[model samples]
Target chain A: MSTIEIAGKTLELDADGNLANLSDWNEDVARELAKGEGIEELTDRHWQVINYMRKVYQENGDAPSIRKLTKESGVDTKELYSLFPKGPAKKSAKIAGLPKPKGCI
Target chain B: MAEPIEKVSIVISHGSLEGVYPGLIMANGARMEGIEATVFFTFFGLDAIIDKRMDNLGVATVGNPAMRMPGGIKMPTWLGAIPGMSRFATYMMKKEMEKLDIPPVREFIEMIHDAGGEIYACKATVDMFHLSENDFCSSLDEIITVGEFYEKSAGAKIIFT
Candidate 1:
């Protein structure tokens, strides 16, 4: 594990860069993380995906895969790639402060 | 720093819902990891790309020794051979996948394509099945020979499902 200082708080992150402690997540932390991923601004659309992921994780105990994200997160697949380029599911989960979604190779 | 995996190629050889999903899921997962991913649909796997059949792919319950119920109980092969069992199993699996928000096969393929993953149909399989390029989903990248596929897949991790 490694630590990243976000919003004056040092938080542990797994090797995959996912938050080690889900409780350490906040909007500020998400913004910090998103900045590192090349997203300078967090639009409402971005929040929609992050909030949906966090809600589903809290209920299902794991982050949803890209399939679920695109289908149920009010974000289409094309918009997801544009919102979280390269790897939407993984990147969004990191910004949402959730674990790396299971079933992703 | 070590280089992350660059590419991955998956081969889908079976037609059942159970058979097709592993390849799709793995390819999607690879793309989620920023790895270039490709899926080669061959033989029965062609069912997944066939324009008319892709959306209606069914589970193969008969002769499948690994069939299981929702509670994880093993289903006997003999019982699986009963009429409508395959359709019933497909329905159950589809329901479970829907609950988890997994897209159906056709949409899944489109998602992969839109995500920049490549979809291929085996040329031999297409010829054998009397299917032309028009018979496949529009997302199909190409129908190439096994030799050509191997050439393109060289240096990439290969997975057979």
Candidate 2:
């Protein structure tokens, strides 16, 4: 893990660039985190996936996979990829301050 | 760390659940890692993209070792040869996969395609099986020859499953 300055706060990020401290995340932090992932801006659609990921992680103590996100996360696979270029499951989770997903589909 | 490879071109040569899933899973996994991926269905692999047979494909239970019971007990060869054993094995495997949220064959194809991975059929295999363009699933990107496959797979790692 390492530290990066965002919104005037030094935030610790894990190896995958995910926020190490949950309390360190805010909309500003999320936007900056997303920018590091090559996402220029967090539109409403992007927030949809991020918020869903945070909610699921909060309730289940883990992040949902791509299947769960597509099936119930109010977004389909195509749109999810468009929103977060490559792996939406991991990318969106990082932006949501959740750990990386470990399972393979 | 740097990405090991840029793209993968998977060749699925088997029709059974064990045969086809390796290629599908690999391609889908590649896309998940932000790598380009493509699946080439040839020979018995055609069964995977064939709309009429895709959903009905079964795993091999006969004349095979490593087959097992629910608790991991080894399955006897004789038991595997029973008339309905293959179907039963396929059923059990599907149920297990469902519990893990693995999508069915058709859905998996759609997932890969939508994730920017390409899917295709071998022209020679399609002809050998007396099949036509209309026989494939809607997600199939094209029906090409071995030479065409090689061309499309240029600069990509070739994985035969």
Candidate 3:
């Protein structure tokens, strides 16, 4: 595993440089991304999508598109954003422990 | 935004004659752009997969105003329920496609298959709808569930019409 500090918070990632949060990412990372700082709470649905995204990144070596993620996880895009607030893949991906996906920036 | 890579996997969940065409058209368009494409047919969308009915498809009329001629006239949704509507819609769509130099649905399917695109049927939808493999085109890749489709769609873009 490795770690990288974005803003003031240090994020722990796996060997493949994936998001290490897995299914437990509350809003800490999300708050960090959204407010460009830190967070305190996250929902179960957030963890579900983050974990699924991590799995997908591992297998495909890339982040799944929002549409694919929604279809796979059966989560609506609106619900996904409500959880992330800033953006689903951007903040969620960071907390999930994934490297910055190409084409997203 | 990054130009989407040509490696997109598209899952189409429509089976109506008109509805089914979008799936095929987009799949073929993806291939034309050299993107990896896949089409999953579920529910009534299987009508396109069924070899017997593929050649005959219909247009959307219910609450749909685009079902008119070049003059942009209005037509009834119930008109699509008529016997000949399917055939007429099929012909009209084909004609418009030909005018645009787009391939016919059959040819488009074949092109997609030959170009390494995938075609699948929804197993649950088939079971629920009382459809069998024989009802679909012989070129199908598999009869999969939504989960399988999701897995396949991973890392790819999805366009739903």
Candidate 4:
């Protein structure tokens, strides 16, 4: 476990560097995490995926896989990779304040 | 930390349903992990890229000792030789994979292609099988010679399945 300051709040990060507490997530924290992931600018498209991932986690207790995200999140695979860059499944989940997805897609 | 895999080149050498899925799954998994993937379909594995037969791929129930009944019960080898056994086995496997959200071969190929993974057919195999470029799915990037395959594999880990 490690802690980092985001938007003036000290937040604990899990082993994968996701927010340890989903309740700790906010728009500001997301921007900070996005920057850390090299997404210097989080556009509306990025927020669309981030919100969808967070919603899926809230209902299913886990983030959606890349396939699921592409199939249902209104974003396709190429765009997902472009939006999140390397490792869309893991990187998006981390930015969405969710655990790393477990299974291979 | 382990060094990340930047690129992977997979060679699929067999044509059976079991033969093809490993290469497809691995290539797709590599792209999901942000690694660049190139799939080379060669020899009998060309069946996977051929539009006419790709969707109908079946496990060879006969001679496959690992074959099992629907509920994991061991099946007698002789039963696998029945005319429809291969098709039946393929149907069952597809249903099970669907429950896990894995797509069919056609969709899987499209997914990998749409995600920017490269798919190619082997030139030697294509000629031997009497297949033209038109015989393959649109997702096939090109029909490449072995030398071209090696060129793409340069600096990348090569996996043969």
Please provide TM-scores, in order, for all candidate models, with all chains considered together.
Answer: 0.84, 0.96, 0.54, 0.96
TM-score of 3: 0.54
Q: Give the per-residue lDDT of model 1 (tens digit) for A42-94.
A: 99999999999999999989887787787789889888888888798888888
Tell me the tens digit of each residue's lDDT in model 2 across B93-146: 999889877899999999999989999999998888899999999999999999
* Clashing pairs in model 1, backbone N/Cα/C closer than 3 A: none
User: How high is the DockQ of candidate 4?
Assistant: 0.73
Give the winner by TM-score. Answer: 2
Q: Cα deviation of B26 in candidate 1 (Å)?
A: 0.9
Q: What DockQ do you compute for every candidate structure?
A: 0.57, 0.76, 0.01, 0.73
lDDT by residue (tens digit), candidate 1, B1-161: 98778999999999989999999998987888888898999999999988999988898877767789778899998888889988898999899888777788998899999898889999998998888988888999999999989998988999999
List, residue by residue over A51-96, the lDDT tens digit for candidate 2. 9999988998988877788888999989988898778888898899
Model 1: lDDT to the true structure: 0.89
Q: Which residue pairs collide in model 2, if any?
A: none
By descending TM-score, how would the candidates be arranged? 2, 4, 1, 3
Q: Model 4: how far is A92 from its true place, Å?
A: 1.2
Worst 10 residues of 2 chain B by lDDT: B61-70
Top candidate when judged by lDDT against the true structure: 2
In Å, residue A68's CA in model 4 sits off its true spot by: 1.7
Docking class of 3: incorrect
What is the C-alpha local distance difference test score of each model?
0.89, 0.89, 0.65, 0.88
Residue B86 of model 2, lDDT score: 90
